[model samples]
Target: MEALQSVYIPGSRFLPTKRNMRMKAIDSEVQHSIRRIVNNRIKAMKAEEGNYDDLLGVMLESNIKESRAREEILNVLGDQNVDTDGLNQLKVVNMIFYEVLRLYPPFVGIARKADKDITFEGFSLPSGTQIALPIILLHYDEQLWGSDANKFKPERFSEGISKATKNQVIYFPFGWGPRICIGQNFALLEAKIALTMILQKFSFELSQSYVHAPHIVLSLQPQYGARLILHKLQ
Candidate 1:
């Protein structure tokens, strides 16, 4: 854990220290292990046509059964290209995106510096004090999001962001206020369009080779990469 933490320390990779070299070696070994696991799973899948009742298998099965977002997309857009008007009508897709962002935010945290002396929640903060807000922690907070905070429930944003967050600043996947991400709308629109296109012509499932090891470098991502089995729709 210490070694892993050291890898993310600013300028650690640029240094010629022995500790950095050891960390790099450890990272390589970890990657090798992940590759082996993926290869073994692929071999197992190829060897048999039997049903997999593993945790991921069961979860995937459940997701397949429960998800109606694709159906909504098909109904809304049909075979036509996604447009701004059609995109606006995709309530379900938007909700799913919001839920996804809430669960797996692109950036794990946000950094800000205090411009002036101020008191927040009774604590006094001087100017130039750098603060790091862990967005994932707030995202999964049970107190703010109820008991199923960690669970994937897109319906939370069915009414809209204001209602879902009760107009609080707790939910800010793309940051909040004036300094919020300028490309937030464009990014979501682009994602919605791309996802709409994909769902229109393909059905996908998590491959048995998929390993759910999410880690953060600059952003939250699958440590070993996301492996999926895509089947084209008729």
Candidate 2:
């Protein structure tokens, strides 16, 4: 992919080359088209009173809805510091984390090698063949996650990961199987603790200048960085 190449190939983005210029033009066009489509959709939604029933419509209809998550955390831990037991009880918070990770997985992809010759979906590959799994693509796949896959509906994980993924290899923010990240639980626990502490004292929203630009270096990151305005709770 050109985007991947731009990141992996040294000096490709900065070099004044034909390929780089073409990529930039293509990227600009894609951005402009996406912006136009979204703006048109917003305008259409405003002009209509009918139900949307699509991803964009759902997103526009959805509200912050963080009160439930905050209330769940408060009920589980009150003003106390987050503990393992309390963290486990914060179901809504856990769902929010799962949804966030699904949308913005830290790693865009994962690499693996076939230990032995294998046949998959009519393709036969010899041993030692390399495979690259695109996590972001899989996460956003409509067939795997239904039509509203792009929306931030955390309730999908309400019944747990198994139900959310239909007992498939579709969802894996920290990779899957035996080679899954060993620190997955620890990392999530750390995040839960930090989030719990913050929610206990403040409410936050995106700042006016915040720009949503998810880019991948080694891992997925916000290109412009996330800017938030936090309000202290009295």
Candidate 3:
């Protein structure tokens, strides 16, 4: 619970303060979804090939810098804690989440219905055939995203999601509106808090033994395993 940089919080300690609750409405659903993904994804990776240390690093950092904020919430959400600051400050966590999702889409493919009729590049499409939105097409789009679109670049999100997507539909790590990922806020909050803690304490990288193939079973996941190493902080 010690302060890492001696940077005191901006507000006073006496009044009944209110934390940012932007994602409060979607907390439950987001919690469930996050749990399923982390658990399943971790399990999918081979035992020796996975990086539990990365998670450890996050925990250490959270312990050192955040204390009361993330820890208390951790009690309620188990290991996950939804925090304020929205998703902007969550660049690193977002990267981890993106890497996880890109490697393992929760739904893989999207299903949609036609309103009437539609046309493609030069073909006429009918209105009845249920169409599938290939998530990978956008997730790995070289045109929309750059060549490293397939690579993990948390810096891309450092400025904002708009910059990452070039303000296009290429970045739907979460989904599009009306029925977009409802719990996105909650999940993101949790991811931010968790990742903030982790990054603050340790550094990490993929191990040489790690594989590149991601498979889709219930979600997109590593076919072999995800291996990474972490170094603890003072």
Candidate 4:
């Protein structure tokens, strides 16, 4: 139900409404089945013999580093009792992801159907009409992002998401509003943890053969696959 509702399918919205009790029941069953499968896979992982260094392990390691950093900060201040929950020393990692999202959002555009007639910016939109929101264009607009809009500037997000641009609405890589993607937080946290682990383990740069063109087929992707030269850290 979650995946179907989010993905652009033929009749997703029309399928499992309050009026369609039968379909709703089926949807619930499908969701349960997916959860059961995921739990089983986790159990299988726990049952395995060999050691594995995965995202969860990496996050656990990061948690230890965070504790140490917190203690160091407390020692410097001579106040060990101060709360450290609000501190975020890993904010730079977040900025890197923000810049990546600005340059190449997962979805090039999102479609919305208008149920009623509306007028905006001197343009009229009739009822029962569909519109494609050009997200990347808005993301890269110089008016909002300043003269260096074309450049990859992760430092822009150092002050936080709200201050990243003059108009905060312009940065909606996960879409916006009540109908925004349900898994937005999950996706962001996953990316942050993965990027943090990668940076900790290796140094990497774009390969000489790398291509920069981006295209979309359902979701935005590189026209040619990204090539990187990774050097492992000891």
lDDT against the true structure, each candidate: 0.82, 0.83, 0.59, 0.67
> At residue 63, what lDDT does model 3 achieve?
36
Clashing pairs in 4: none
Per-residue accuracy of model 1 over 1-234 as CA lDDT, tens digit each:
865665476765769789778888999999999788656654554454423456644454335432467888888888888888888999888988999899999898999999999899999999999999999999999999998797777779999999999998888899988889999999999998888888888877878888879899899999989887778889
Q: For residues 106-197, could you state the per-residue lDDT of candidate 3 as single tens digits?
A: 67778787667889789676887687777777777777767767554444665666766778776565667677988988886676666666
Residue-level error in angstroms, candidate 4, position 59: 29
User: In model 1, what are the clashing residue pairs, if there are any?
Assistant: none
Question: In model 3, which residue pairs have backbone atoms overlapping below 3 Å?
Answer: 58-198, 62-197, 104-220
For each candidate in turn, give its C-alpha RMSD to the true structure in angstroms. 16.3, 15.5, 20.7, 22.6
Give candidate 1 misplaced runs (Cα > 4 Å): 1-62, 65-67
Off by over 4 Å in 4: 1-88
User: TM-scores of the models, in the given order?
Assistant: 0.73, 0.73, 0.52, 0.60
Model 1 weakest 10-residue run by lDDT: 57-66
Task: Assess candidate 2 and give its TM-score to the true structure.
Answer: 0.73
Q: Where does the lowest 10-residue lDDT sum fall in candidate 2?
A: 56-65
